[model samples]
Target chain A: MTAKITVEPSQKRQQAKQLREQQLLILAQQILQQDGFAGLTMDRLTALSSVSKGTIYNHFCSKEDLFTALSVDSLQRQLQLFQRALQIPGHSREQVLALHLAYHRFSMTEPTLFLCLLTATTPAVVEKSSPARLALRQQLELQLAAICQQLITAAIAEGSLQLAAGQSVDALAFVQWAQAFGANALLKPTQQLGLFSQLQPQPTMLLGVNLLLDGLNWKPLSSDWDYHASWQRIMTILATEAPGADGQLN
Target chain B: MTAKITVEPSQKRQQAKQLREQQLLILAQQILQQDGFAGLTMDRLTALSSVSKGTIYNHFCSKEDLFTALSVDSLQRQLQLFQRALQIPGHSREQVLALHLAYHRFSMTEPTLFLCLLTATTPAVVEKSSPARLALRQQLELQLAAICQQLITAAIAEGSLQLAAGQSVDALAFVQWAQAFGANALLKPTQQLGLFSQLQPQPTMLLGVNLLLDGLNWKPLSSDWDYHASWQRIMTILATEAPGADGQLN
Candidate 1:
């Protein structure tokens, strides 16, 4: 009974600490959305929050640490979305496409967080971030990569996909990640340039992924199946799961 | 004779102004290389250069404008590299891979300048930049896109490739651009993460481009011919053209 009393109070303290940290993170995200990277200062965060400066500092040592923390939060959100995507009923190829779609949705709905992910990767930011936070971010990245890796492995096992003699699952997964990363990163900036204004009304991201899958000679190639229909179905199902999160789906 | 005499002095003045502008840009690049983006300031540039503050401001209205100008210069260098890559003797598909190789080389050798291109695209930088410089950047982007488009068009015209019913030349070119950009952007950062250390030995950038081309069913596909050999040949030829530019090409 004495031990329970001692452990209960410590557990309560830990829970309270986690709650405050979550509040700070949400506040930090608001500041980022409102003022961007330059506007996110430690003083601003301290001033805006009800928590004392000392407590805030305990949560994050510096602005870069806060940024890294934000990246971890964003990546956690992304991992959740990927997990949700995997639950959708389909072939492994469609599940892979769904993963791409989920990523696109994340980039669209949470652009500030998307930019945070990009910024956290830079040398300047990475150099200043706390090692614990950096390790957490790396762990999240590996988990995301492993999710894609699992889908690829399953496809190969089921005989829906075949690798060339020299190709490895990790390399192919990296290639797919690069394509998705490239497509989404370029999407908004180039669209703002009106670079796509002259092009036909086709989904460029879908086209890129389709080409990559077809290159892999994965089953149900673009020529052999209406992947466009599959894309629409996945979008509909995802929208139902997260209503109004992304209404910009074309 | 009177008109010629009157125009000579003004023409000479213009030439002198252009010379000073070039010198300022070179000095700014030096500052950027040595100290990075945050260290670049008009005060620093004025202090470092022989020119006065007023003259320096005349060349670049703001730091963002200077960044835009630097991006314009970088794009011009990329344009020249693409032109050189086109001069290599090979199929149009090989020429396309050469374009990717040239871009990889540029990103490797001039990472800071490549980053300038990315920063110049952000809304904050674009909003502050002078309209004239932004236009120049856009024009350079178009010219680069045109180079890729012509390759795709040639491949299709010669019966080496075909697009789906909905795919357009502009869309395919954009896809290829995204792949290259994403691959290059992620390469250094992820490599620093040691993400590829466990994977088998392979040239990933080459793998990405080859998969993309294979998806398009371009002639001499990876399955039918040794693209690894073509990549090596292109690298050798490009190395002869620009010796010591990229010694790290794997």
Candidate 2:
């Protein structure tokens, strides 16, 4: 009876610790959204969480580590979204577009969180991040890449896509990922810099993908079909809040 | 004679101002290279440049403005490199790959400078920069985009490339820019994340561009011609330090 009672206290303590860590992350995210990276300081987190500096340090080794943890959380959410996107019924190319749409929606909804992930890529952040956290980030990325590989394999098997002489599915998948990442990351800055006006993220992204697929000679070519219409359909199937022709999220 | 003397002093003053600004920028770049963004502060600039805070402020409104100015300098260099890349004689598509190769070289040679440009896109930096600096940055970007546009237009006119239905050259150019930017930006992080062991920046980038061009059905398809040979030729023509087959920069 005494052993059972002691075990119950330890389990309760573990649950409370988990609850506090989650609450800290939620507050950190709020702070990031309200103010940019410059606003996220350890003192502010300590004040906001009402947790002592010692306890906070126990949860996260440092401020960069905390941000790394947040980035891991963001990546987890992305993994979840990517998995859900796979279930959206469509052709393999459209399915790939759906994955792009998923990332786009996530970026739009959580711009600050997206920025946090980008910031984590900096050498300063990577250098300071805990090994365990970095490993977790890598594992999550591999999972995301696997989902993309499945889509690419499907496209090739269905004869809608063909690999070039030296191109592997992995290479193509990385290219698709890099293209999407670049478009989304540069969208705001390029707009602010007055480079590409009337830049529709969803359409532009789909257009880039379509052109790449067309380059790959993926069939039902843009010349033979309306990929723009397919883009809107993927957006709907994915239930994305992607801005429409009017640039209003539906 | 009195009027001539007064004019001479003014001209001398203008020349001196320009010299001082250039010196400050060089010092700032050194500081950035030696230390990351966090190491860049007004005090450090003053200490390094031996210029008073007031003079530094006259040159740059704030620390963010200093970074913006650095970003502008980086963009100007990119513009110069892109123009030089254009002089590399090749087919229009090869010329575009040459442009990509030039950017890849710049990223590899001056990763820190490349990062300063990326940091400039952050909201905190953007929000704090002066209007004039922002305008200069935009104008530089437009010039860069125009260079890419020139290449794309030549590709289409030569019957080497075609625009899909309803696709503008501007859209295609932007897509190309995004692909290059995405591939370069993600190259370091993806490798650091250990996601792809064999991810070579040059080949992966060339492959992505090849796939994109192939998707466009740009003539002299990868199946018909060995673009890898062309990539090496571009390196030779542009005199790039692009890694050899052994992946060592020449």
Candidate 3:
């Protein structure tokens, strides 16, 4: 019996580990969907996943670690979907409009996951999670920056629009991205029951994106930059100067 | 002790009640600012407030009640400050611009509070504290509606813009307000870093608001009505038909 038990060990551990990961992930989703964040517990996860108690500890050290893994996977899928929404400029504005649609679609499709990531994103949660949390934020921002860069650069080259001096086009992306977050977080539920269905984020997206474009537009003084370019001039100075802000340029 | 208490009891109950309420309110804020939502305990409220356990219960039946009153006060103050940002839009464009700045300013100043009221506006919390939470969201929408209404109303009156035959000015307000919520909540963090100082929402506000204005510009051939709008429209409709989706809209 002792010899047979020893023989059952090595390969079973690897196979069990793989199965455990899949089960934990499924358990994590069920916990999120059924109980919300506050309701999650290690005992619950083990029971729901039908995995052994010691096996879980061998895999994940804590509930937060397990949830974090689940969250990262969820975010990756979201970013992949979001990438499709970001059309290069030659594409019709309908394609541009689709980007905003993509955001809401993600939020609706993954409300529980969305809640986990975004709700966990509060400074309160982030401070403790530290490097992981910060990295997640930067990751999302980078994707946003890439999409925005493509759109603005294409728009400028296509001559459909122009950007002003010193605007990263990346910064504007951050703004639009943030606005999209807000729309998902605040807009839909605030509306008078189905109002978001009647209206979409096109206008909001256009307003934010177009405004950044208007400022960056070396289009012409005749267009009446109405925005008072002093702000733009400041940004341009900061970007190109490369100053340490301690008066040294790096 | 009983005989001594009986001598002053009934006559001082009203005064005692007010004092206990004040103490409870202070304790609730202490819990919020220090411990956050999770750490707020009834025993903690009683201890921190320096009021007796029974006294706190006498004024606020539960810890949640104390939180409700505290939230109402904070939210009301926030809206008051935010609305001041929307006062008297100097131009059709200014109306939208002012709204964005006002929103951004308020959010940056009071992010955690905004997160509490706007993001954390869930039903479990709202079912008990209906008036305060519901009023805040509705009030926000009303203000946003007013801004869009003012812009469209001004443009229509001046002949600078037209409304599609069946469209109402309120249509623009709905989208504008929703976007405002989005932009304010998401963008403030980066904007505060001054990384987005140049993108200054003014232009985005103008462009997006203008796009909606233009989209709804009464182009006779426009057939894009009578369809499901997008995203939160479903929630908005559900909210309307039931009026019980969540606590606050924004």
Candidate 4:
């Protein structure tokens, strides 16, 4: 494995730094993919990456730092893919559909990485680490929010848009997002999730996009100033008593 | 730990046989709740429950058998609850909302039982022995189908319903289930899930449910169908996705 016999000190330093970074990432991915996030360790990293412990220390501040790099890479990939797709011309629904397909394909294509990032069980993981989960959710929301805005924009431009009182695009984005997460969470290989098997998340993920589009058809569907009315109703339901109501609130 | 034991041979035999079934189940639940399902073993059960190894052998064929018993019990609980809920008077939307609350409550209350029955991390689980998954999914679907029928009944009764092509209570049920799972899967314990603390689950879950309700609302504001449709949509988006899509079809 030692092909290089000699090198200048500066040249060797540069090469070692680059290689160490690569090694840390490779080991990180390996830990995430092969062992789950919980199994990731400096010992394992040293073994998998074939680097000295000190070299890894040179690159990352801590194990948390190493994991952060991995997460950022994953989220950036998703964002990049989403952005690239957004540039393609199609109906807002179709665009959302394409994004879903992309998501589906990504999940299947990189099962280990996909599951590692998306799943809670992956070893070497720190569940309380905000940089990982929050960044991920927020990144996803950003991409999805863009899609919602795009669709609503396109529909309005074409005069095919209609929306009822509470059909804001931002609100719709969360709807679409929640649905996607829902889809990802309960997916198994053999059992058909039953009904959602047909609508194809690729298109329907525009649940928000569709909500705005479809709501456009409703007579009361428009951006109005009735936020307080709905807020009061929700608060009343939430804060006040509904007879015989008993359940844990998040 | 043995007490003063002076049982006759026939009495010992009769007592062992009588206690075997309940003893095994209690031990299994205790093991699962304490050390997780992995702690459950025949040796452990024999030791923990203070039953003879041979007695355990007579009670359960294997660890798998014990787990299956637990699985069956949990499934039956859910099945009975769904059936009981169906007997009540409510709109389709209310019923679906109740179902969501009911499911959320079940997961929070009996988390260990929930994992044994539904949380399959092993890839070969559903494919190797699928009767459990199928039976459970089918059992839940019965409840879902009832809600779907109720939603349709209410919407049509109110005369303000319009569906965009494919819409079945079964499909609606699936969507609600999937969405709930998706939103839920992303959740981590509030304090520890990375840098963002406020991005907690309650709002995240609420966000998803709200979106589905919005999407599924196919009724004008003047009709009760609107409310029913909205609630059903919420259910479809939230509840439809928890089964994990790794090995299941949605």
Top candidate, metric lDDT? 1
Candidate 2 Cα misplacement greater than 4 A, ranges: A1-14, A157-159, A240-250, B1-11, B35-42, B240-250
- In CAPRI terms, model 3 is classed as incorrect
lDDT tens string, model 2, B110-207? Answer: 88878878778776678788999999999999999999888889888989988766677888888999998888888877886777768667778888
* TM-score of structure candidate 2: 0.87
Worst lDDT run of 10 residues, candidate 4 chain B, spans B120-129
What does candidate 2's lDDT look like per residue over A1-250, in tens digits?
5999899999999999988987898899898778766787899989987889899999887787887888888888788778777777867777777788889877887787787777777665666778888898899999898888888888889899887666788888898898888888888778866788866677788888887777777777777877677777766765643234122223
Which docking category, incorrect, acceptable, medium or high, applies to candidate 1?
acceptable
Candidate-wise lDDT, in order: 0.83, 0.81, 0.52, 0.51
2 or 4: which has the higher DockQ? 2
Candidate 4 docking quality: incorrect, acceptable, medium or high = incorrect
Least accurate stretch of 10 residues (summed lDDT) in model 1 chain A?
A241-250
lDDT of 1 at B103: 93
Q: What is the TM-score of chain B in candidate 1?
A: 0.90
Please give, for residues B181-238, the per-residue lDDT of candidate 3 as tens digits: 6566555544543345567554544344333333344222113331112212332332
Question: On residues A1-250, what C-alpha lDDT tens digit does candidate 1 reach at each position?
Answer: 5999999999999999988898899898898789876577788888999988888889887777887898898899899889989999999889988999999888888988887776676544666678888888878888998998899999999999998876789888888988888877777767766666665323777888988998889897888888889889998887788775442334
TM-score of 3: 0.63
Task: Return the clash pairs for model 1, or none.
Answer: none
| DockQ, each predicted model | 0.44, 0.52, 0.14, 0.13
Query: Per-residue alpha-carbon lDDT of model 1 for B64-174, expressed as tens digits?
Result: 798889889889889988998999999988899899999988888888888777667554466678888887888888899989989999999998998877788999998
